[model samples]
Target chain A: DQQVKQNSPSLSVQEGRISILNCDYTNSMFDYFLWYKKYPAEGPTFLISISSIKDKNEDGRFTVFLNKSAKHLSLHIVPSQPGDSAVYFCAALVSGNTPLVFGKGTRLSVIA
Target chain B: EAGVAQSPRYKIIEKRQSVAFWCNPISGHATLYWYQQILGQGPKLLIQFQNNGVVDDSQLPKDRFSAERLKGVDSTLKIQPAKLEDSAVYLCASSDGKDSFQETQYFGPGTRLLVL
Candidate 1:
């Protein structure tokens, strides 16, 4: 019963290219979505997030787009760098207090 | 400015053994969470604490898993009579105790457990 799902298990992109990671959710109760990037030995680090009321949020090189009607969200990293190679997990929750439901994660590999 | 802290970065234990993992959230953050990340899978929430009180622990395996936050700052998760499937990276995360939708959770390096 995975409420959040990342359909792609892996993605490969060239350096300086744009990398897009997609995630879908079945639960409409989830109003907040988050993207976390994780390196090989470290815990998942918060990258970006969006709320149900908004359609897009961007910070630096990362941008997140949310479509409530589609129950979908995506993270776009422009000009991908080698350092961006890592497993990215998408999570969703109704609010801050509730535990987040996470996707299995998509491993992104940026070839240099 | 320090991130969440976890100790004993790596541990190897046998089946039926007992193991404990500790976590220290960031200063002034009142929310703490413990998650289990198996290989090729995302982190699964085991428990969450807000100011020493449990917010959620529904997914916890109560029979073998127990956790406590004595002072509301640091927490410990223990698994008694562990099973091989219990081997995974235990992650501790924290966030500011706010009721907003923009809160971001900070994570620790994580403690990797290998049950043999």
Candidate 2:
């Protein structure tokens, strides 16, 4: 079973606008959540992460918000740029010692 | 510092043939992991190791798959009598320690295997 799910397969947004990607998980044991960005034919690169203790974490123009009660999280990018176009994956981990469970991923297209 | 390294970026073979992929983690990183990603799907963990010892392999198919990490550094994954469903990109990643809750993992480009 897929513990993490990204309902949207793809998303499109115009440049200089906010792009929101959503993810949900069924396992409450997961305490750490992360987002990774991947380009075609390349490995995934870590973007940002948030601990379950906090409801939100921000890094530069990227922000991650977590709702433990709902078992959901979202990533928001402000003033999205064309360079932001890529596949975004959401992952969750029970701890540093365990392997991460990933969502199917969402393809984000930022139009110029 | 160099990131994780993988060999044989692409491979194609007939079904029931044998194939192997290699991976070298970042220097001084003790935790290594292998993952398989199918088209339009998230990556699935195949195996994990901590300093030459296996931490998890619950998802691995023992009948056809085997993996090893020698000297606590590099690793190899082998599939004997590969099946058509085994066609996917094999990814390697590494972290400084087993507890990666706070540490960032580095991933290699991955080896794309196509089984006909």
Candidate 3:
């Protein structure tokens, strides 16, 4: 079973526009959520993360919104840049010692 | 500081052959992990190590796959008698603390393996 799900396979946004990516989870026990970006042939890099305690967290141009009641989360990048084009994956930690479970990634393309 | 390092960026082998990948984590990191990323899929954790001892390997195919961290610094992953479905990218990640629940993992570029 897919514990985490990213329904959108790809998303396209124009430069200087807002790019929003969404994710959902079936397990309410997950306490920490993370987002990672990956380029072709490269491993994933950390983007932003949010804890179950908070509803929202913002860093610079990126923002993550978590809704515990719905078991859903989203990542928003304001003024998307062409350089931001890459695959994004949403991950969740199962417990204190368990490895993180990842969702099928969504590829984002920003056009100039 | 340097990020995680992986060797043999690309490897091609026939089915039933043996292949190995090596990784050198960021200096002073205490936790190490190996992951498998198939095409169009998110990465899956295969194993995790705290120092030279294993913390988790339940998802690992222990019958044909093996990993070791000799001195709690560097690590190696190997697959013997490989199968065609084994084609995937192997990623190595390291964190500064033993508690992965609270720490960030730094990832390496990864090693791509193709089995014929």
The sequence of per-residue lDDT tens digits that candidate 2 reaches over residues A15-75 is 9999999999999999999999989888888999999999999999999999999999999
Distance from true location, Cα of B30 in model 1, Å: 0.5
Per-residue lDDT, model 1, residue B102, is 53
CAPRI quality of model 3 = medium
Question: Of the candidates numbered 2 and 3, which has the greater DockQ value?
Answer: 3
Top candidate on DockQ is: 1
Candidate 1 residue-wise lDDT, B3-114, digit = tens: 9999989999999999999999999999999999999888999999998999899999999999999999999999998999999999999998876555778899999999
* Candidate 2 CAPRI grade: medium
Task: Indicate the residue-level lDDT of A96 in model 2.
Answer: 55
Q: List chain A TM-scores, every candidate, in order.
A: 0.98, 0.98, 0.98
Please give the DockQ score of every candidate, comma-separated.
0.73, 0.71, 0.73
Give the Cα error of residue B77 in candidate 1, in Å. 0.5
RMSD of each candidate? 0.9, 1.1, 1.0
How high is the DockQ of candidate 3?
Answer: 0.73
Error of 2 at A68 (Å): 0.7
CA lDDT, candidate 1, residue B68: 99
Candidate 3 residue-wise lDDT, A1-112, digit = tens: 9999999999999999999999999998999899999999888999999988899999999999999999999999998999999999999986475688899999999999
How well does model 1 score by local distance difference test?
0.94
Worst 10 residues of 1 chain A by lDDT: A92-101
TM-score of each model, in listed order: 0.98, 0.97, 0.98
**lDDT (Cα, tens digit) per residue for candidate 1, span A2-96:** 89999999999999999999999999999989999999989999999898989999999999999999999999999899999999999998875
Candidate 1 chain B weakest ten by summed lDDT:
B97-106
